[model samples]
Target: MPGQLFCFGFGYTAEHLAARLLPLGWKIAGTAREADKRAAMQAQGIDAHPFPLPDPAQALAGVTHILSSVPPRDGHDPVLAAHGGTIAALPDLVWAGYLSTTGVYGDAGGAWVDEDSPLNPSSPSGKARVAAEAEWQALDLHLHIFRLSGIYGPGRSAIDQLRAGTAKRIARPGQLFNRIHVEDIAAALAASMAHPNPGAIYNLADDEPASSSDVVSHASTLLGVAPPPEIPLEQANLSAMGRAFYAESKRIRNDRIKRDLGLTLAYPTYREGLAACLSGAVSN
Candidate 1:
């Protein structure tokens, strides 16, 4: 479709998504929290500006697509309180997406969860995300929610963790987690935008949901190094907030996105994805 798109809190995911969508003939605009980053975005051919966190009442004129990659706040997002109306009032906007977390489906004990699964978030951040998703869903707009899992890609993967000597296999029993390569996320998003599916919830995750230890062990094996010593979940010395995540166990399902958006993920599992990251493979 021929339209202008806006991405709020345009971080890593949005950056990669924008790079893909631009060449496909979509006009783009995005927010920057820093002045230097704004300049850098403009230099890289993005229409860069500061979009007030709680977006202002002023309309964005003709933006047809909007994606919010802003991580949910620790408790509540005041941005939603202030700018929800502004977002809801956009007349020309056709598709709006809220990036959330699968942690909202708290402690399923590795049972599978699809789009219609109940939300019982354990962490403060996850609870906040559930609330945010509610706000957008109630807006009567074309809304799609992406409950993302562990996000890893080029410079942000097991390789980085292993090389830095910070890769530890935390012995959290049944703490299965899902992940998606950055390229697959970008691809899934582009598919959604191109073929708008409002009021849809997509679990943006890979096919496999492996335990934390499994990932660490596989990553170490791939690197031809010994796995890091296992740290018991209780004695792991995690921050109070980090410990909250360790408290839950769940596995995400991405079948909805596959059936709806026709997404065949480039990296279907952490094993393939992490291997690609280590071997310098790119998504086609």
Candidate 2:
């Protein structure tokens, strides 16, 4: 099952997944938008190529699995537009995964949302994801959709934000956000690769959906620093993107991944996840 895995956007999540699969004898190759990033990946032994792959067929010659973490561009998926035909023609392609956002289920009013929940996206990015998902589902391939929650791990966690003095405790009463560790996301993806279930939609989130202030405060406690003062959402002086994120809140459900893929998250909540980040205990 570990033949060749090609990732469309080999960024943070894809890098973590590669860390797991590479050790299992899988040949890893992917595209990065920046030449420097491509060079870094190639230096780390990945067969990295630039985005908008110059020769799609030649690059994807022996790929058994494909994962696309690329976001939509101008209301359409770039990967499908560029290489959908070639990918559909691959004879030995076994599984294909698309990393989507749980934001598609926008502003559940902090209510729980599962794979069956109806999509009501409020942001342009979320709407683009809905369209991209439809396009992927339309293709004749073994596809699995992973609607990921806020991904946090290692250098991307609240601890790092606090250390960088960018940790904000914006107060939106009753607003909660769901999060998942990158390692857990990699684990779930690996489990799904082992048990390929076509047409499945899984939510990749942790057990707890907590407020942003709570997460920041916990990270502060771990770092032995005073938590930043909480500012009301309206007075937070956030950018449009930040305000847009604060406007919607939802508690994502992850029962399907556990039931279908038999995955148990290593860091089940922000507390354990931030602790691991502080202790530098991240592992594959």
Candidate 3:
């Protein structure tokens, strides 16, 4: 059957997925944060609506697949608060996806974590995602929870940071993180749709995990620019939010996506992903 997708938050990751699915006989509809963006998406032939949707039932009219990139706000899921019942009642809805975060696993001391890892979030944002995942799972829908690591792609990668002179190389020893390109995220989501396994939780991350400073240095080398001088972790003046990222260190395992859904990451590491971003293969 031809698919109809309704994305609750048609932001960066969801947009990439829509780009892939639109040409394959998929009808896309979603909620955008701004009026101008909603108009723009409509011009692109999407059934886009304003967010905090006053009439979610209307927006959900013929949606067979639903994807939510909406993060929880103030300890509650906005989507579940507004239209959880409507979604539960939709008889023909085939799939629902929630974009979660690996932060829910808390600090693993640079150890690896998989889908079955325990939930122990260290930050408020991470805690909120954990709660949101549970709320979505409780709906008893054909739900797929994707726990993403650090997300970077296209205009959002380190190449953009280097060009803008905003890239930093904080030298925190043994601090490692896994990241997934947005395109890879879309591919994994698409694969899951083709092989729907309800109640599946997959980690959407690259095969290799590395320190932030190393990745920044690589981007600088690729751009032929002088890399930012490294500042020791203790000497770096970081905001609370930025420092929170340093408090956690985990190498996320992505074997489940490959094993279960047969998905392979187009960019298995930050090097390949940043290269693609610099080459104009992806747009902002």
lDDT of each: 0.83, 0.93, 0.90
Q: How close is candidate 3 to the true structure, as a TM-score?
A: 0.97
Ranking by TM-score: 2, 3, 1
Query: Which runs in model 1 stand beyond 4 Å of their true positions?
Result: 53-59
1 or 3: which has the higher lDDT? 3
Ranking by lDDT: 2, 3, 1
Superposing all C-alpha atoms, what RMSD in Å does each candidate have to the true structure?
1.9, 1.0, 1.6
Clashing pairs in 3: none
lDDT tens per residue, model 2, 77-190 = 999999999999998899999999998888899899999999999988889999999999999999999999899998999999999999999989989989999999999999
Highest lDDT among the candidates is held by which one?
2
TM-score of each: 0.93, 0.98, 0.97
**Most TM-score-accurate candidate:** 2
Instruction: Provide backbone clash counts, one per model.
Output: 0, 0, 0
Q: Relative to the unseen true structure, what is the Cα RMSD of model 2?
A: 1.0
lDDT per residue as tens, model 3, 1-284: 56999999889988899898988889999999899989988987889888878787787887789999998998989999989999998878999999999999999999999988899889888899999998998897999999999999988988999988788999989999999999999999999898899999999999999999999999999999889999987778888868888999999999999999898788999988999999978632
Of candidates 3 and 2, the better by lDDT: 2
- Model 1 lDDT tens row, 1-284: 56788888778998889889778788887788899998988887787768574335443557888888876565555446647777778888889888888888987877898789999988778888888788778788899888899899988988779999888789887788888899999998889988987888889999888887888899899999999889898778899777988887777889888998999999999888889889998885
